[model samples]
Target: MQPPLPGPAMILHRRVVLSAALAAPPLAAPTLAQAPAPTEAPRTLPARLLPVPRSVSAELQHRIAAPYPANWDHIPPDTAGWRALQAASAAEVDPLLPGLIEALRITVTPTTIAGVPAFDIAPRDMRPDRQGRLLVHLHGGGYVLYPGRAGAGEAMLMAGFAGFRCLSVDYRMPPDHPFPAALDDAIAAWRAVTAQHDPRRLGLFGSSAGGGLLLATLLRARAEGLPPPAAIAPGTPWCDLAGEGDSVNANAYVDNVLVSRTGWLGAAAALYAAGRDLRDPLLSPVNGDLSGFPPAILTSGTRDLLLSDTVRAHRRLRRAGVVADLQVLEGQSHAQFLDPTVPEAREAFNEIGDFLARYLGT
Candidate 1:
């Protein structure tokens, strides 16, 4: 008297369906208020300076100095005094050559890469897979400092740790040759490398001014429709030749190396720019189009005055959809990546090797 068992049609009919629909509450309709807010573009903030590390090598810590002299950049270019200063600077590092050679365990062979004077630094026991792979190094000295074997330290460490053949470009610099001179020599080296091996098998790397030049050279390569190298490592690059960046001001005297943009660093850029527009993309890769650039690995230290340059370049590369990696060491300063005695420096080179191996298969 449960009324006659519901008939088959009643059990499976529109009535049953309607009853269920009525029993359940209706879903709310989506509206603008319920939708997610659109994501806003990320903005950069001024970075706070970090305290120098207590664990830094005493040798490095001792070398730190008061802010550079106010008159460091006062000398005019191409003058006898300027020439003398450059010479003296070169002389300072000359004694360190033997030690650098020993620490890196590289054999130096004089050679010409693309008609540019360069030195080939080969590791004693390179990995078999890295046999034909090569790295072309541009030394950093603003644009008028380290020259000759004195500039080979970075390349030596790279060759030693990365197990790749390295050619350190001994490109001419200001007072004698400037601007396009360094760029031209870099390109020549690139052409030479490409002639002997596939461009995809090569890597370009440098620090500070040399790092900036590596980026500039890449811009030139793209403009000329040349094949880009497999990867590049620009360590704390002075990418903004115009001297634009928050760290340029924030880290001023805080960074012992390249102490200030208003000092010798500025003068060196002026000598290299030689009256060219600082905003010129060739001089400041930051202002250039980086869309099609090869994968890049950028290294810097928290205390480096050029930390802004490295960060900006990494951000730009990401915005352009290019593959890029940035590694910032705690409490180190400008170009500290070249110090083999520093554990951070050795790790930096290994990180670069891993990046290149992924791209170049060596």
Candidate 2:
């Protein structure tokens, strides 16, 4: 004889019992002695297996097949090791810039703003309406990678695609400078840029660690009485360094880049944070008040580990009465939109360009 399957009545009864239990919840706190052991406190979910969807473009599908780079799994043992890894990553990415620059017809020049290193990017054929507008970009590299010319890739892409002048801030990072250093440089650059351009014509943008930094910069700028940008675009922002998002676990092994927080991602956070509290508004802007923030366009993908972070930030901004737009790519993971070869990448930037143009002045 076989066991009986759950009948509709039984299911209804279960739901009724569960609802009654939920409605009756008003238990007092348990004593420490009565509390369950810490290790046994957390409930576990069954393991899952996911497949890459065919909904995205073929190029993106190929990218999804091999999401991470060769060195994505290697954990650096020391500062020297981290530097070597950074150099290797830069070497791989830097060579492709010249071709992209020529194709996009954008000129990238190294410059300093408020004594901080940066790159000024301008398109040859600028949009007449965007002539007076300026965008300040911050590059994403876990707050430690992509230094010098290597960090200007995203700025070039935006300038070429969006027809706007961009200043990519090559902020100082950890292993030498940590915590407040990058934030300080960003603030200084913001102050200098605002001095030259009208704040109403200025926009801010960045991704991953850069996205997180962009939000932190806004919070710090607000506290310091600095004028806000007309708009902002934070793509796949690592908003919570403490890794408190559901996707952090749900998207584990799902996102090709920044594979898991337990790996290099968490290490980078610890390295950049130094000994500072992870909840500091300057470190994790998600915990900060975003009441007076300007209109924002937050981007993420279904498979991105930071999807939760981006969604949470957008919700927070919306709850604070700000006009917040969210764009979720079909199958991207992490900052895959940075890849110019991907069709969706272009579409993502186009959407961002349109969003910024809506708020920016001529």
Q: Which is the leading candidate under TM-score?
A: 2
Task: Give Cα-based local distance difference scores for all models.
Answer: 0.81, 0.90
Model 1: per-residue lDDT, tens digit, 187-249?
988877787788888889999999899999999988877788998899898899887888988
Residue-by-residue lDDT tens digits, candidate 2, 1-362: 11256566767677655655555545243234433367863567677866778999999998898846556667799999888877876898889889989999999999999999999999998889779999999999999898888988999989988888999999998888898899999999999999888999999999999999999999999989999999999989988999998999988788988788888889899989999999887899999899999999999998899999999999999999999999999888998998889899889999999999999977
Regions more than 4 Å wrong, model 2: 1-49
**Clashing residue pairs, candidate 2?**
none
In lDDT terms, which candidate is top? 2
Can you give the lDDT of residue 293 in candidate 2? 97
